[model samples]
Target: MSALGAVQPAEAAGGTRAERGDRESLFRPLSAEDGEQLPAEIESLCMNCFQNGVTRLLLTRIPFFKEIIVSSFSCDSCCWSNTEIQSAGRVQEQGVRYRLAVTSRQDMDRQVVKTDCATATIPELDFEIPPFTQRGVLTTVEGIIDRAIAGLEQDQPIRRATDEGVAQKIEEFIGRLRQLKEAQSPFTLVIDDPSGNSFVENPRAPQRDDALVVTRYRRSPQQAAALGLQGEELEEPAEPAEDLHNEVLQFNTNCPECNAPAHTNMKLVQIPHFKEVIIMATNCESCGHRTNEVKSGGAIEPQGTRITLRITDPSDMTRDVLKSETCSVEIPELEFELGMGALGGKFTTLEGLLKDVRDLVERNPFTLGDSSAPDRTQKLQEFIGKLQEIIEGQRTAHFVMDDPAGNSYLQNVFAPEQDPEMQVQHYERTFQQNEDLGLNDMKTEGYEEETGSR
Candidate 1:
């Protein structure tokens, strides 16, 4: 520090040259520090951070790094020999670090700007690399093509010639192949294209030797001959003869001779008081012989007659007698009345008249007179007594004297006993007779008569 002593005399008069040197040494550059230093690990970490940060900055400015390498080449004396010396000099001048840095920064700025624009318009390049223009790119492409060809040969032959035309031809061929495959085994294989369209194709078609052809069933020649028909001819069946006598026979006749035709005469015959009858007589016109073929009998008897009687209700004088012409009963001293509408005239009958009168009396017993009324009861009793005497006289003539007509009349009178009015009249008459004849007198008379007769 002899040089220090000579130079620092003006400012370091207060300290020795050595002290000043020590103080100055404390303010020296960090690189001059010996023991006061960062650790090697920390230095290495700092260096890495700086380097990575710089790399990130360069990468951020140069967006082309994200894109696939489209081209790469180097200019050298050997490669650009035709260039003049002046251009060479300019290129050499551009090789300086400052120049390179400036040029590289400008390129990075341009790439970042273009990358922003390209990213939005690069949809076609979504899964594809850029077109290669580098020197060795052709060799890479050739290798890729070879690999593709090898894969296709190993798998299956290319059905179509070129990639662009392959899709359309494959589609048409696949359509036909699918039909064939479906006809054979009902199985199908579908292939899908990158554009999300799909088609079915039959790979099995190439393996098959023959195609299938659909056909309709046909009879064999031998079968046709066995069935008594020509192999190629079809015949219609003959119609059957019409039958004239299939229905049921309304009338039957016997032909006198084998060749003689049958004839029948039908007639409508009516018997008095009987239903009309249909008679069919079959005759052989040639032989003049006849026989009864059909005779439809009727339910009505030819000699029978129908008589009806009607008794009107006492309360309804306008009510006519109910008549039934279907019954057979003859009554004497009765009038014949014609019925209205379709009903024919009917003659009165004894049983029908009696039954009707009995029904009428039974239905209206009060019309005869009420036995419970004092005056009417006496009158009814007197009338019933007279009627009893008349009935007894008829019965005496019939049962005791054997008078046939009287017996019949007595039977008719007694038959009315079934009627309620007639029964009450008989009871009242008997009661009155018993009252008129004293029980003792009747007893004495009966005793005297018995004694005299004995």
Candidate 2:
């Protein structure tokens, strides 16, 4: 907000997505006018009729903050419902954090927590719940741990063959958490949020002896950079990479599909997140057919790169993903994939990319036309439904992009605090790929540049 936070509507601009500091808001902020009372706890409106509104809401005073309110609303006519947690007090420029010890089951319910841009950790268990990956919620300490467990299971990141030890440790961590929840073990829970909207319930402060530890510190420089608040920008490049980029290869041949004359266009353009790769496009003049493929360029990469993301919520749809021409994308759960030539390199969000796949499969005249077989159309219809399910969060799917050229990325808002599922794995490239990228060449500094094959 504008220094003084205010509860803003969804359409309101300038404020954050989590600001709710109005007088009628759920919570009576610390800076509110003296003796100001809030509106009714429950209310609803007919979004369609406008005149008719119902009272369907639940309001509770959160024990942690003075007069803090949590509310849930539902509409009778449209069946729309939403739960909101309103933060109290003034603008928390530095943010607030909470650390509580969980020694008994009774403490689980009492350890207040707030999160969204929040990261949580259980020190005794060595379990961490990453920030931004989780939906913002006001929950108990137990609820937070439970959510982390669910996230781990839905992600299914552990592989049987690779990182077996890490997988085992994860399992052990989960088991210990269960024990902690049962009050069989004691642990410490830390809730750190940079948004300044979070807090823990602590009655005793500096005045009296207190077990609670509350620390308010300025955001780190790197964190400020990631959050887009402030940071030093990178120095200007000597010259844009594209200016120095050169053509790689070109050839003329009959179109593979139509057997008609065609010219192949090849260029070495740098992908933003990935490395440089040669993009080739062939168009047939006779048949009006086109094909494209991405190949490794320049010196061969020492390792291939794999990027993975789990589609779990609506927020995940907005994640920026880059798939270079050489990248192979797949959704294992749906058994659908695109090889190099089947799709071209581009940058897009998960939502935009999935929509592209749907349009190509369901609306394409070439694929689902009148002459198409009934069985094929039926299968495509089923796949389209699966895609819809993923978008609606009815199902979970893992999206992976494997690029031999190491030129692909699933970008995160906070690069340093990347989620586990959104990862980049570097592995050895295949010998064939090494040859394709021309890594076999030994010529280097001061060596003569040769045009033809040795």
Candidate 3:
């Protein structure tokens, strides 16, 4: 007999009186032989189940099967009698599939037995198995079915061992599982399986690389509990150490010559192939003598010397001052040409100096004349006149001293306090004119000549 025909007697025998009464209320009763013929109301009830909440059904097609059963119950409340369903084929068509059974509760027993039938089609079985069945009958059924399918596909009977042997195998399996779990790095274990295709044994605990082996087997709750395993927990890496030596050096030293604080602080300046070198300059406020110091660690080494005309002109001169101590200095970028003989002892005499200045002007043509001002010829004329005065002063020194040969000329010409009255008057007039002309336009010409004088 077909599966539906096979279930007919069982359904009739087990159904409660209330169910029978309800059936009678809906339609006429059938003879024992005709019990396979389903009532016309059965399809409407099945349609109601479909419309209400039933998400899946298994339909078995059996020739000459007269009736099938349909019922709805939650998994928790379901019994064998109220769970089975019988239905009669009301409409038949070629290649049309039908639901053999459906349940209101998603997790209910969903197995279908197709007796005396070659094929069956079930539809819409997409609900999760109830949590309660995860450990009980459903688990056993799943294991049995899996083994059976494997055996059939492999065409062999799966072997079984004694309890002691199985226990030893399980212990070995657990050991291997633990090794796998412990072998993974902490970072690798934190990955989440977003696709639901893979399973992680410990979703919260990281796998250790040394003690565990990661495998494709899905871990059970018992196995996880046995290993005391949890999910992935990531650790934050510690911050890197800072270079304290560089920072400490920056705060301690002043310029070696100027005694003014060095702008580079104490951070060691490095030269290629030089070890732990620091270049320091000291400017003496009293004498304007700038000295350079090259040091390794704390030991000073005499590399070279630099002399800056801190008192640019006689206007900056004061009483004679001499250094109490000797020091080495370095004047980088200060260049002089051979055979120049320091023409008037100034930078203009240097051939390379003029070439560099000309190159600079050529490279930056925009600086040759003021682009904002309209009168270029007047500006050029004024600049030339200032240059003429500087040249005349350098040649004769009459502008700065009454007698160039007198030693007092150097001290008196630049004495700020000694010429305070004349300086104050000149400053007032210059300031007023500068304010009127706009300070940005008050250019200083012949600075090289004025400042270069010894």
Q: Judged by TM-score, which candidate is best?
A: 2
Candidate models: Cα lDDT each: 0.25, 0.60, 0.27
Writing each residue's lDDT as its tens digit, candidate 3 over 114-133 gives 21111121112111122112
Write down the RMSD of candidate 2 (Cα, Å): 26.3
lDDT of 3: 0.27
Summarize candidate 2's per-residue lDDT along 1-454 as a digit string, tens digits: 1211232322133132233243224443332334443444434454554533443322233332433334455566667654445443333446556677767677777536465567888777667777666555667777777777766655457453577777777777677777887888778888887766676754321012134555555677665655566753443623335444674455776565434567987776675544565667888766566776555555435688888887777888888766676677889998776654234666668887788777666543223333344665566677889988887778899988888877666766565676866766899987866654556575565554454433
Q: In model 1, which regions exceed 4 Å deviation?
A: 1-259, 297-454
Q: Give the alpha carbon lDDT tens digit for every residue of 238-341 in model 1.
A: 33224312322234444432224666655554423223334455566554544442232333221222222222223212212222222222212222111111
lDDT of 2 at 322: 65
Segments of candidate 2 deviating more than 4 angstroms: 1-91, 155-169, 203-209, 231-454
Q: TM-score of every model? A: 0.11, 0.36, 0.13
User: How does residue 41 of candidate 1 score in lDDT?
Assistant: 17
- Which has the better TM-score: candidate 1, or candidate 3? 3
